[model samples]
Target: AQSVSQHNHHVILSEAASLELGCNYSYGGTVNLFWYVQYPGQHLQLLLKYFSGDPLVKGIKGFEAEFIKSKFSFNLRKPSVQWSDTAEYFCAGLDYGGSQGNLIFGKGTKLSVKP
Candidate 1:
């Protein structure tokens, strides 16, 4: 089965530090990629997504992700991060070849932004 993998399980950085969380998906056919963030006590929120059109898509709160089909990667990036950005980020992929709701997700990357 296709899956998603995040390069880092935990990441730490000071406020204002640049952030990049590596994410790769292993789906043979057309796929949709997404980044979801969950704060300490909040529900999981959509950070960014890539379905079609532009390879690079920007999402809420200065977050963006590039869909590099050549590498099967949809890495998330932010020029600078704030303490409030600290959260658990998940990389997910929806496979078009499978049944509906066939979404695979990575283990998740915990981002800790220090002030």
Candidate 2:
């Protein structure tokens, strides 16, 4: 079965700190990757996506991720994170050629930022 798993359940950091959240998926076929972020009291929004092309993809808010097919990983990264970055991050995917385009998401990674 296809699924996603986020290694970090929660993370705490101060302002201007580097951030890296692990993400892994168990799918053997073509997949469309995505990272969605939900800020405190805000709706979920797209952070990044990898459909077809280069493995490294950049998204809004100075965030980026690298898709390694061999490892079945798409790790999110940020050089310097801000207090505003405090939010829950989710890694998701859709099997392009599978039955449906429904998204498969990980439980989530909660991030806390202190000023």
> Which candidate number maximizes lDDT?
2
TM-score of each: 0.95, 0.95
Clash count in backbone of candidate 2: 0
Kindly provide the TM-score of model 2 when superposed on the true structure, using C-alpha atoms. 0.95
Determine which window of 10 residues in candidate 2 has minimal summed lDDT: 93-102
lDDT of each: 0.92, 0.94
lDDT of model 2 at position 97 = 57
Model 1 segments more than 4 A misplaced: 97-99
Candidate 1: C-alpha RMSD to true structure equals: 1.1
The C-alpha local distance difference test score for the whole of candidate 2 amounts to: 0.94
lDDT of 2 by residue, 1-115 (tens): 7889999999999999999999999987777899999998899999999999999999999999999999999999999999999999999998655466889999999999899
